[model samples]
Target: MANLRPISRVVQGQRMKEGAGVTICRTVGTSMLRNLDPYLMLDELKLPAKAAFAGFPDHPHRGFETCSIMLEGKMEHRDSQGNHGVIGPGGIQWMTAGRGIVHSEMPGTTDGVLWGFQLWINLPKKDKMCKPRYQDYQATDIPVVESAPGASVRVMAGEHAGTAGPIKMRNPGLLMDVRLAAGANFTQEVPEGWNGFAYIYDGEGKVCGTKAQPEQALVLGPGDHVVATGGSGPSGLKFLLIAGKPIGEPIVQHGPFVMNTQDEIQQAFRDYQSGALQRPEDNPWKGEEL
Candidate 1:
């Protein structure tokens, strides 16, 4: 029998705002659960359809990567590297701020729903200052697998049913968006020693036999797999299953910069202030395409 990992801790997200005026629910990044190995923060951004001018503006990040997933609505991304693109519903943008980069994430009106998540993934000590890169994909790029009737799993940055996502991470990790109909059940195997957790964003469900409500972050204990079942309610359930290998290094973070030491964090700030973050030759995009 497969060992199901039970929920060890449950934390509720707090309402917060980012950029100029975007509202979000911050699930991670708190002092209690500051750093989850290679993973850092996870922000759930849910806005109204007319939420124009309510998005993240130009900002700098170094020694880490930002992975944004669009569950609904449309979002446009522009960066100092000259990368510009628009990701619609179900699209994803993985930005690697290896050394340093300035970027903005603006929103556009689409349908009635405007929901998304931006996950901050920490880079390893060796790859902290590597060259910046990006991995952008559309809704059709990701693969969705059906485990059983009324249960679907969308592989974002990991492997599922022999299919793999295109986004690559320096530190091994897994990200999956799952949806289950009422009374449906879903299970996924997780590698041992990898820190794993689940964030329920919609409806009700039971993770590892523990009842969970929306906006709850469930930390998983040591086990080989996790069992999640939809609640008896009519709305079903939706969540993001995230797991990553622990980097096991010193973590020094200040605002958008994440480094292995305080001196490195200070240097990142200095480089940004001196405009030495990105070289002219480093940018491959020339306002044509991203």
Candidate 2:
């Protein structure tokens, strides 16, 4: 029998304004959750149809990566490296701001509701100054597996079951989008010594016998596997199961920059201000403009 993980801590997302007056439900990076090893922050951006909100404009980042998963509507991304793309529903854009990069994520449609999640993954000290790159995928690019009756899993990164996700990162991790029908259950095996968590986004469910509500992030304790059961609601249950191998390094963050030391953080700011953060010649994005 697999050793089931227990819910170590439950963090309620705090609603706060971000970008250009857009509200976001932040689960990690808050005072309640602080930082989670290799994972830094997770934000749920939900813009209603009636809300007049400006999206995130050009911003700089360094020593980390940003993964954006679009669930509804569309988002356009443009970066200082001359990379441009649009992620529609079910699409994902993973950007590695290794040395540094300035990017913008704006809503592609103003008439529809926009919903998505952005997760920040920290890079180790060695890879922190590496070259910047992007790994983008359309909805069809991601592999989905129906592991059990009424349960569907989308493998976004790392391996799940016998299938592997398309994106590769400096650090090994798992980012799975799971959905369960009423009364259905799904089990996932996590690697030993990895930090993991689940963020419930729709309906209600149970993680290791603990009730999970929307916008709640449940931190998992040491175990070999995790179990999630769907509630009897019409929408069933939808959540993101994410885990990463801990970097075990000191984290010094200043706004969009994340580095190992205070001196590195200050250097990141100086590089951005001096227009020396990104190397245009080293840009790995070769796609056509959207």
Candidate 3:
């Protein structure tokens, strides 16, 4: 028996322009104009064979973290810390913007086509300003273990069965990039009280018993395990299985700013307006972001 997992309507990814890049999937998340706390927002970017679609110029971030994962092509990241590198295919870069930081992501070519995923995870209020750090985990550095007949799980956070990922953080969470071949099914447990959700990337499947398509998402009820079964794609189904322990605090976010209070959000805007938010002088790619 499967529960027709509760889900919102499926909407097409719209054309939305952001600071440095364009957004295809518009109107994301549950509420109309509000973002899910803890998990702010998730957007998808697809770049064709050409090189014109390179992403984000130098940008300022306060009180949040930005995650970039190259799904198809290559993405080069440079920041104020004087760090620069290319994340290809399965490579991922997790950056934390505590008090403040400035950085940029420029899309690149690989073979011919280019594709990837950029995820943003919110930082808890207490740990928000700790410090800014960059962790680039090579594809091989990420652990991928087989769980069931036709399913594979890539553990990015939290414990999966007996395996864990190299990408550790202060936030108690789990991020698994899972893939399922047709007819294959896999079930992995989640923390007893962890807040989690599953979003389909390639194919359709049943989420805990409800039917979900690549066009839709499953918010998932309070549970311990997420079940994804393959359906249509002979090419196989891809999804990002992510979960996080709730921080249980007020979230204040405005555009690129994410904080815990209205005063903090206002301060973030003021800082950026005063040019204090950009990467400092003598920093990596100084004065590069627009």
Candidate 4:
């Protein structure tokens, strides 16, 4: 007998402007759902094809990791550590801003609509100052598991049906992109004490017993697994099921940086202002071509 997770609360994503005036739907880092333990923020990018966008300019970050999942468009990333890459549809770029990092992500497509999501995951105190690294994967690089008759799951971070994601991280977590046909059911095991949620993006569905719609995030309660049923719509349902172990530490965040204390947050600012946030010697990817 498996314990099914229940929907603790439902939060609708709020529209906000970020980076260089890029419109995004923010779900996790808002007043509705402040912070979810190991997860800090989740933003959905939906830019029109003909829209004029400035894109995200150079920025600094620390004490966390950022994962960009491109669903329909392309994004180009370049960091101070000399790591550069372009992730297109069905691709992911996972960057660990351990000690510190300065980077920029800009639109890589001009004539096509840009759609994606950026997730911010917190790092534990022990590995907060570790060396920064990146794990990028193309669509074909990731593993997909046929979970049910009409359900498929793309494992992004953790194991699913004996298949594992390509990206490696300091923290243990699960990031999955699930697609379900109409009336189909899907289930996945989640750690008992982990905090997690599901963000519906494509169609409507029922998470456990609660009705879920697009742009709605269902914060889950304690359980050993989650169960969901696809909507009756012609397009079916699509969502991102993300869960992670709790860091259980004080979070002090200032704009792009997140630390465990106010003093550390201030120090991050000082380091960035003094142009010493990321040391030159610490950049192993320097001068390497993408």
Instruction: State which candidate has the highest lDDT.
Output: 2
| Candidate 4 wrongly placed segments (more than 4 Å) | 282-290
Candidate 4 structure quality by residue, lDDT tens digits, 1-290: 28889999999999999988888999999999989999999999988734625789899988998999988888999878777899989999988887888999988878788999999999888878777778889999988898789998999988888888877767788999999999988888899999999999998879878898999889999889988889999878899999998989999988898899999998999999998764554555321222
lDDT of 3 by residue, 1-290 (tens): 23323333333334466545544343243254244445776666665735436467888887877777767778788766667888878888877777777777776663566666666778888778656767787788788888787778888766666899876566777788888888888777776566666767677766666776663445656545667778766846777776777778888777778888999988988887786755454533222221
TM-score of each: 0.94, 0.96, 0.86, 0.95
Q: Candidate 1, residues 216-286: lDDT per residue as tens digits?
A: 78998998888889988887989999998988999999999999999998999899999876554345422
lDDT of 2 by residue, 100-209 (tens): 88888888888788999999999999888777878889999999999899999999987777888987777888999999999899988898899989999998979888
User: Model 3 Cα displacement at 144 (Å)?
Assistant: 1.3
Each model's total of backbone clashes? 0, 0, 4, 0
Arranged by TM-score, best first: 2, 4, 1, 3
What's model 3's TM-score?
A: 0.86
Candidate 2 residues lying further than 4 Å off, grouped into runs, are 49-53, 286-290
